[model samples]
Target: MDFNGKCFWITGAASGMGKSLSLLLASFNTQLILSDRDVKGLSQVADKAIALGARVLTLPLDMSDSGSIRKAVSGVLTNVKRIDGLYQFAGISQRSLIIDTPLENDRKIMEVNFFGVIELAKALLPHMIDQGGGQMAVTSSLVGKFGFPYRSAYSASKHALHGYFESLRTENSLNNIRVSILIPGRIQTNISLFALDKDGKEHGKMDPGQANGITAEKAARQILKGLRKEKKEIHVGGKELLMLYIRRFFPALFYYISSRIKPV
Candidate 1:
C-alpha cells in the first residue's frame, strides 16, 4: 500500500534499522510516531525527519516496562487518528550460553522482545479494527526460525513472536489486520555491542558476523518492500538466508553445520 499520508508507529527509533526506516518513510510523505527509551536519540531522529519534511512525534518508550508502553500508546491514541502501520523493533540480544545465563537475563529479553510487542499490539488491535485495517511488522531474527549458539533466550523470544503473530494473523484476517514477521540475518548494527551477557551486563563488543553483515539501511529498504507486498514473512540478509532453507529441507545437515559454527 502507499505510505503517503499514512501514520506509522515504530519502536526502537533511536538507532539502527528503526532510525533508517524513519528517514526512508519520511521521504514517502508519511507521518511518523517514533518511540524509544533514549529520549535524546529519539529527538535527533525526529529532527532529521522534520528536516525531511515529515510530520514527526517523539515519545519515550521503555519496552521492558508496561507502564511506559501504556503511556506511549495512550499518547498515540490521543494524537493520531489512526495507525496505518506498526513496527515492533525494540529488542535486546544475547551472547552468552544458556547454561551460564542468569534467569533474570532471560526474563529481561522476553519482556522487551516478546511481551512488549504483544501488549502494544493488543492495545492497538481494537483501534485498527475500528479503522477497518492496518499492518504490523515485527523484527525477528534468523534464529527465530532456526536455533543457533549463544542465543537461547533471544531465539526463544523471537520464536514466540512467530507463533503469536501467526495466530493473530489467522484470527484477525476478518478484521483486515495484517502481520508481517521480518526475519533478519546479521545486520551491521550495534545490537551486539549492547547485547546481554550471562550476568545481564552488556556484551560491550561487536560480533564478527554482525560486523560483516549487511547495513541497516539495506535491511530497512528490504523490509519496506516486503510490507508493501503484504508478505506474511520476509527474510533478509546475506548467506544466512540459506540457513532457513537448509533447516527446512535438510534438518539433520543443518543441525550438524550449525553445531560447528561459532556465533560470536
Candidate 2:
C-alpha cells in the first residue's frame, strides 16, 4: 500500500527495528505517531523523521502500564484523524531459565509483550473500523511457533500473539482490517542487551547469536515488503527460519537438536 500521507502508529519507536522501520517509512512520506517510554529517544527519532520530511508526533508510552497505553491512544485520536497502520513492536525478552526466573518476571514479560499489545489494539480497533480499514503488524518471534531454551515466558507471550491475531484477522476480515504477524528470528538489535533476567533486571549483555544476525534495517525492509503484500504472517531471518520447518515436520529431531543448542 502507498504510505504517502498515511498515518502510522508505532510502539517501541525509540530504538531497534521500530526505529529502523520508522525511518524507512518516513522516506515514503508517511506521518508517524511514535511512542515509547523513553522520551529522549522518542524525541531523537521524531527529530530524524521530521528532518526526513515526515510529519511526526511523539508520545511517551509505558507498555507495562495500561493507563499509559490508554492515554497514548487518546492522544493519537485527538491529533491524528485516522491510523492507517499500527505496528506493535514494544516487547521484552527473557534470558534466564524458567525454573530460576521469578514469577514476577514472567508476569512482567506477559504484561509488556502480550497484554500491552492487545490492549492497545483493542483501543484502536473501533477507530480503525470507523476509518473503514487499517493494517496491524505485530512483532512475534520464531520461538512463538515452537518452544526454546531460556525463553519460556518470552516464547509464551509470542505464541499468545499468534492465537490472538489469527482470531482478530478472521473477525475483522469484513471490516477490511488486516493483521500481519511478523515472526522475526534474530535481527541485530539491542533487545538481547536489554532482555530481562531471573529477577527482571536487564541482562546488560548481547547474545552472540543476535550480534551475528541480520541487520535491523534489512529486517525492517522485509517487514515492509510483507506488509505491502498484505501477508497474514511472515517470517524473516537466517538459519533460524529453518528451525520452524524442522519443528513442524521433524519434531523429534528438532527436539534433539534444540536441546543441544544454547540460546545465550
Scored against the true structure, residue 131 in model 2 reaches a CA lDDT of 91
Report the backbone clash tally of model 1.
0
Q: Which regions of candidate 1 are displaced past 4 Å?
A: none
Clashing pairs in 2: none
Which pairs of residues collide in candidate 1? none
- Cα TM-score of candidate 2: 0.98
Q: Cα RMSD for candidate 1? A: 0.9
Model 1 C-alpha lDDT per residue in residues 99-208, reported as the tens digit of each score = 89889999999999999999999999999999999999998999998777899999999999999999999999999999999999999989999999997899999888
Error of 2 at 162 (Å): 0.5
Give the CA lDDT, 0 to 100, for residue 9 in model 1.
98
Give me the runs in candidate 2 sitting further than 4 Å from their true place.
none
